[model samples]
Structures are given as structure tokens and as C-alpha cells.
Target chain A: MQGMSPIVKNMTRLVAGFIVLFGVYIVLYGHMTPGGGFAGGVILAGGLALVVLAFGEEFARKALTHEAAKTADSIGAMLFLLIALLGYAGGVFFTNLLPVGEVGKLFSAGIIAPCNIAIGIKVGAGLFGVFVALAVFRRAGAGSSTGMIEG
Target chain B: MDPVLLLLLVLLGFMLAGSLIAVETRDLLSSVICVGAVGFGTSLVFLLLGAPDLALTQVVVEILVLVVLVRVVITRRDETHATSRATLPVGLVLLALGVMAAIVFGTLATGEDEGLTMRPFGDPLLNEQAEASVMAPAGEKAPEGAPARMPKSAGGAFLAHGLSESQGSRGTGAANYVMGILLDYRAYDTLGEATVVFVAVLGVYAVLRKVGRSRHAGNESDR
Candidate 1:
């Protein structure tokens, strides 16, 4: 699909970076702040969706392919499960096995940070994959029923 | 009522109005936008309730929902699918409302006076009592080794003792109580939620991929 107007493309180029950075910030600081993995992941997906909206489907596919998204989604899920399983070494499932440093600091939370990261990755990739799939399906539907609907 | 409560009431009113408009509107795009407005208003309500975490989640989820729904609506050419038959839906809604009302009234009728009456906003008596109970010295133990009984109010106990080193119990090391509860104390539940999300995404992928492949096979067969 062709992209939007030059204005929108230019605006997206300028704004998408900051949007992504903000999402990352939210994900990283989730343990201390209000925003967590889920919220930040959705925000990250939104930033990417903005790029898809501005630059169109073809450009988005090039930047973030379906295969890559699927891989990332699986990797994220595996990482989360790995973290949970790792807790078994500490004598219980999903236990906070790592050392809990001083409270109120960024790295103080033992397993929470890693858990948040895993969740963020999983949610972000999963959402983007869904969007791509929907878009591709829509394009295919349009192709098959083009003249049938118009006439 | 406090000014904050008044403001919250106004926001709730707008939320209701937006939802009503969203349901009543025939134009798909307008309906989606109205639903988004309602979602945004709900986030504001969460903020007013002093739950910034919930507010953030609500806003981001709303954005994602808006994007996906708008994409779906825009892709389909058949936007005028509004039917005049509203009896079944209306009746179902009324039934649900009746159930909710009955539950609320039943709780109010059967609940004890102490349980029914909420503490005044920003009351500190509960916190003080919780601190006294949990922070007591070892010498104040009742019998053999059992410590003094703690406060019945879980919220008060958490607020008073969950952050710092109390009598013999070590508080959850995390500064954020919500994170502590979700990730540390109840990590299994969180894992379950994550699994649910993963399954949902997988379902979407499977359904879409199947449709695409079937469509392709149909085109090839026609040739």
C-alpha cells in the first residue's frame, strides 16, 4: 500500500522515535512508576502503529516483517517462562530468587524488572503481529472482491 | 462531597454519555470515536481514584483498542449493518442491570454496620492501629512465641508494615506495593495472565493465517 501525504510521513519520521523512547522508558521504570510492562507494551505498539499509519503497509512490512514479529513474540514468551522456571532453583515456582537490593532504587526489585521486560516484549511483538495479519488479510479481501463490490 | 469527588462524578457522567452515543450512533467511525472518548474518560476516573497505574494501563489499552477497531471498520465496506431489532439486546441489558441491582441491594441489607460504613476519606486511625499491632516489641508477645494479633484490615496492614522491617516479618522488599503484590507475592497469577494473552494472540494469528491460505487455495482452484 502507498503511504500517506508527505506531511504525515515527515511528522511520523520526526515523532515515532520519541514515542518509542517514551514507551521504553515506561517499560524500564515500570517497577517504580505507574506504567508497567502491559501499558508500556501497548504504547510501544501504538508508536509502531503510528508509523504503519503514516508510511503505509508496504513500508511497515519492510521495517517489521511478519516472520520477525512472530519470532520476537515466541522469544518473549520463552524468556518469561524461563524466568519463572528459574525460580524453581530457589525452592519454589515463581519465587523471587534473586537478591532484593535496597528499596526505592531502580535495580532493587529482583525478578520484577526482568519479568516486566519479558512481558513488554511479548505484548509489543504480539500486538504488532496481530496488526500486520489483519492488514494483510484486509488487502487480500480487497483484491479478491474488488470489482464485485464496486459494480 | 469533596471537590475531587464532584469532578469524578462529572467525568463519570461524560463517560456514560459517551457510551450511550457510541451505541446509538449508526456511523461506524463516529461510534468508534465515541467509545474511545468513553475509554479516555474512564482513565481519567481511574486517575481521580488515585490509581495512576490503572489509569496508565487504561489509556494505553484504549489506544490499542481504538487503533485495531478503526482499522477493522475502515477495511470493511459494509458499514451500514445497523438493524432495527433492538428488543433482545435491550432485554438482556435490563436483565443484567436487574441482577447487579439485586446484588448491590442484597449486600447492603445483609452487611454488618461496621462493614457497610466506610471510613472517612484520608482517615489515619486505621493506619495507627495497624502500626501499633505490627510494630510491637518481642516482649509484648501474648504467650509462647506467637506475636500479637495484627489488624483485620489488610489494606491498613499493608500500608503500615509492608514497606519497612517490622517485628519479625520482613516486608516485601520492593518499594512499590502494587508491583510487590503482582510480581513477588502473586507471580503465578501474573504468569497465568501472560499465558492468556499469549493464547489470545496465537488464536488471532491462527484464524487469520487459515483464512488467507484458504482464500489462496480457492483462487488457484478457480484457475
Candidate 2:
């Protein structure tokens, strides 16, 4: 296939960058907007994928390491579970142990916002890790196919 | 049309288009994109339905599915495509369409009005509080320093309305009251669901890692 023209490539990268920024905005305004952790996380991942496609896979790998992704995923899940456990100790599971503050405010959602952040990290990293693992497996499969022919 | 209804219609349109694509596309990757579109539609619907909780869950699950599906498609990119007859597929499609149409029409005809106040969940507690009449016992009333008794309408205070007579506007403890209901009243069920999610994550991680490692080993052997 012919390589994309310079203009097209630049446009793609620019759009991807915009998407990533918009995702952040949605996530932060989750309570106010029609978006939240899951929506924003996927959008962020989409931007990352676009960058990889436009630039190169190496760029993405360098920006996001497998080890770091795994650690982030684990930590996110653990923090969420800990929050729930804390609620349990307080005689409620998933209870808002923290103050609720004023409704519709940034800090108003209490534990909900933190929970959303945890979910975002967990989902984004877990998804990225899955893709990485699959790519590695696919490469191995290709190598094996080639070997069979050689033998 | 009302803004809410208009939004709902838009979401429904997306859902329809996504389903059509998912069913019509022969390529697995294209089908996966269709599924993602369907997820986007559902998330929008959830947002309109005043259920942010469900919307968040849907978005996260959709990403997980998209990632796994894309990985599969890329790995199998070199595989050959197999074509099938269009006649049988068309016939099947017509039959499915007819069935869906009949079901939808029947359900709509029988369904209650959207504005219907009565529901299968029974009368609302907010409107029926006078009939239920939950009041705390005299001795149970807290001393000056103790936490205030929760109201009947407040979450988790289903058994005895601890502070029905009190005139304070839900007090400064509204958040605590709600939290108590969510955690204390429904702890067992919520915990069960959380445990299930936790286990699923572990399962996905384990299976994925094993798949990766095995493929790596196999590739080395082949080389």
C-alpha cells in the first residue's frame, strides 16, 4: 500500500491528539457531562492507538511500558477494592466514608469520582495489556508458521 | 419532541445501525467495530436514563471487548477469507426481520404508558410513607451527643423510622444516611457482585498472559 501523504498523516495525528484531550475533559466532567470513566478511558486509548498507527508501534511502546501498565492496572483494582473494604469496616460496603460536600460540584460525588478514576486506569491499562500480549502471541504464531515451511 | 425523547431516538437509531453492520459484515474486525458502535449507543441511552452507574460500566466493558477483538483480528490478518452464498443469508435475514417486527409490535401494544406512575415495583415509599408509618421507640431516642436517628425516607432505615417526628431538613448527615443504606442494608449483595468482578479480572489477566507466553515459546522453538 502507498504511504499516507504528509498532510494526511499530520491531520490524523492532530485529530488523535484532540480526541485524547476531549477524553480528559469528559472524564473530569463526568458528573456534569454525559461521559465518565469508561467513556473517557476508551477515548484516551483510541488516541494512543491512533498515535501508534500514525507514527509507529515503537513510539507507543516507549510511551507506555508493559510493566507500568500492569502495575497501574493492579493498583487501580486494589485501590477500588480497598475503598469498598473500608466501607465494610464502617458497617457498609461501598459506602461513602468521605464527605459528600455540595451536589453537582467537582468534589460532590465523594467516593464516586475516585471510583471512576480507578475504573478508568484499570480499564485503559488492562485493555492495552491485552493488546500487547496478543501482538506478542501473533508474532510467535507467524514465526512457527514460517518454521514449518522451512522444515 | 422533548429533548429526552429526541436523544433516546438518536440512540435507538445508532443501535439499529450498529446491529445491522454487526450482522451484515463478514469480516470479524468490522463486526467488532459494529459492536463498539452498539456500545456507544447503549452508553448514550444510559446517560439519558439518569443512570450514570450503568453507563460507566458499559463504557469500560466495551473497551475491554474492543481491545481483545482487535488483537484477535490483527493476529489473524493473514488468514484467507471464505465466501458464502447470498440467497440463504437473505432468506434467513427476512425471517429474522419478520420475527423481530412481530415481537416489537406486540410488546409495544401491551406495554404500559411511559408516563404511568404505577409500577410493578409497587407503590413508591416516598408517597406511601403515611401508610407505612415507621416510628422509633421512646427509649431508642438518642441522648444529646449521639448520632441522629435516620428518617424513614432516608436510605437503610426501612425497619423503624428513627426520626419521623424531627423537623430538621434531612440534617447534615444526609450523605451518611445514604451510605448506611447502601453499605449496611445491601452489603452482602454488593460484595458478591464486587467479588465476581474481581475474579473475572484475575481470570482475564491469567489467561491472556498464558496465551502470550506460550506463543513466545512456540515462536522460539520454530525459529
Candidate 3:
């Protein structure tokens, strides 16, 4: 936790930026690539984790919190599930409620990509929330009566 | 047996094994990990079967479930090992029975459903006439008994025709079409699913929010 040099900090920042960008790329090109919401979300979370690791947990918590992230994550998940359920009222479960556009085009896959984006946001935020909450409870002396024991 | 069928069986075996481990493992973390492995295997099988959409959905759901489970595990008071049931012999027999039943049902179902085939006759005169009616730019009445290449709705007729051609040309619609059918033809079902998600999020929020409020109250009293 000590002696983190300036060069190491800069390198970490650069890698984090790349990881976040790559995650975005994967989510956007989900229809054509092996990477989609899950892969992209984790990649995005990894970027956030790098920042927390290099800078500090306090800084990360300030940027993203469990309370706020929890809301957005819920919204994203709700939207996807809602879309799936809409199919049932139409006489089937998980039916497409919207018209399918030209295949292979960016807007062609109906709501699939939008659903993917929602999932990506939910997952990224959820993972970050987990890590930050743990850090706060354990290292930040924020949760529980068993405070840090000074050796 | 077809190579694809054989491969599917192997994958299913792997999934069953992982799920059994997940259920039988005493350690919570290991069980979670095993459950994730099962999800990953199922997703892979979906991908192989040309259902990329389902695969994507499965993977995303798995990640979400895992994240929630991990969070709960982290917050819980008890971090010790859980008890594993001591019925290995019974478990194996049940597993075998389940697997056999699944395979038998799957094969029987597949055999029962013969896919859509072209009509007995070649393209009827109605089809040709319908094609002409479709090609007619605008302000045209299609002849009687025409194949009705396009829908009656002028606004969406062109779009519908284009969609059918694109989707029917290749068999790729198994995935893409599912999404279309899910949202459009079954909008109501989607509403329920969304509600479930909303409810789940609300439940999680309520718990986490309560935790925060109690902690905040505790801090105030300490002050």
C-alpha cells in the first residue's frame, strides 16, 4: 500500500482507460462479436477497480456508490425483464414488442442491443458496488462494531 | 447419434455435474462458482445451437445473479461452511433418471415437430400476381386470391415485406426473430418480466437502504 511511484500510477491510468474503451467497443459491437454485455460489463468494472486500486478506495466510492449504482442497476434490469414480459400479453412470453429492422444494421436487432447496454450498465455498477461496499466495511472502518484492531 | 447430439450430451453432462457440485458443496463460495460454471456451460450450448440471443441473455443473467449472490455473501454474518447432504448414492441415481428423462423427452419432441415446408405446388399464379402487386409502386389494387405479398397497412406494408424477405432468406432468424417476437408479438409478457426486475431491484434497494439508514442513525447517536 506504500511507495506507489508516479510512473506506476500513470501506467495504471492508461491501462484503465484502455480497458473502459474496449468494454464500450465490445458492447456496441455485441451483435457481431464474442463480447457482449457480460464481458463488457466486467471489463468496465475492471477499469473502475484499477482506478480504485491505484488511487484509493475513498476516491472510487466518491465516484460510484452502492446507493446510486443500485438504482441505475435496477432500472437497467427492469427494462430488460419488462421487455421479456411484454411478449406474454401478446400471447407469448419473451416476444418482440417492437418491429425488427433490417438485419445486420446497427438498429436492426430490435431491442437486443438496447437490452445489452442496460445489462452492461447494471453489471458494471453492481460489481463496483460490491467491491466498494466490501472495502468500506473492511478497510474504511465504516461497517460493523468490529472496528480495525491496531496491532 | 449425430455429432451435434453427442456434443450436446457431453455438455449437458458437464452442466449436470457442475450443478450437483454446486448443490452438494458445503462452502458457499464454491457453490456459487459451480453455479456460474453451469451457467457458462449452458450459454455455450445455446451459442452452439445458433441461439446467440438466448446465449447473450443467459450470460447476462448469470452475471447479475452472481453479483447479487456475492454481495449477500459478503454482507452476511455467518461466513462459515454450510452442511452438505450425505446422500451421494441417491443423488447419483436421481441425476441419472433426470438426465435420461430429459434426453428421451428432447428426442421425442424433436421427432414430433416436422418443420414448415413449401406448399405441395410450385409458386401458384396467386404468388406471381401478388409479386406484381407488391412491385406496383403505389395506388394499386391487388387481384383477388393473390398471395398478399404485402400487408394492407400502407405505412408498414413495405417494411413488412422487406422484413419477411430478409428474415426468411436465411435461417438466422431463430435468434433475431425471437427478439422481434418477444417485444412485438408478446409485448404484454415483457411488461411482466420488467415488473419482476423492478420488484427485485426494489427489494434489494429496500434492504440496502435500510442498512444505510440504520448505520447513519447509529453514527448520529454516537455523536
lDDT by residue (B1-223, candidate 3, tens digit) is: 5666677778888999999899777778788889999998999888877667667657755765676466456545566655555665988999989998876565534332345433222112222223436643478444333355644433333334334444321212223344444433444564455555445545544433334444346558678
Clashes of 1: 0
| DockQ of prediction 1 | 0.48
Q: What share of the true interface contacts does candidate 1 keep?
A: 0.58
Each prediction's TM-score against the native?
0.80, 0.60, 0.55
Model 1 agreement with the true structure over A71-111: per-residue lDDT tens digits: 98899889989999998998888877777777777886788
**Candidate 1 lDDT score at position A83:** 92
**Candidate 2 structure lDDT:** 0.56
Docking class of 3: incorrect
Candidate closest to the true structure, highest DockQ: 1
The residue ranges of model 2 lying beyond 4 angstroms of the native Cα positions read A1-21, A29-33, A140-142, A145-151, B1-21, B24-75, B79-101, B110-205, B208-223
Q: State in Å the error of residue B210, model 1.
A: 5.4
In candidate 1, position A128 carries an lDDT of 83
Question: Candidates ranked by lDDT, best first?
Answer: 1, 3, 2
| Native contact fraction per model | 0.58, 0.13, 0.08
- How would you encode candidate 2's per-residue C-alpha lDDT over A1-151 as one tens digit per residue? 1224678679886697687787676666554445555567666656655555555445545775566767877886776678777777667677666665554566654565565566566656655665554444234345464322222
Error of 2 at A57 (Å): 2.5
What DockQ do the predictions score, one after another?
Answer: 0.48, 0.19, 0.16
Model 2, residue B109: distance off in Å is 2.5
Superposition-based RMSD of candidate 2 using all C-alpha atoms, in angstroms:
7.9
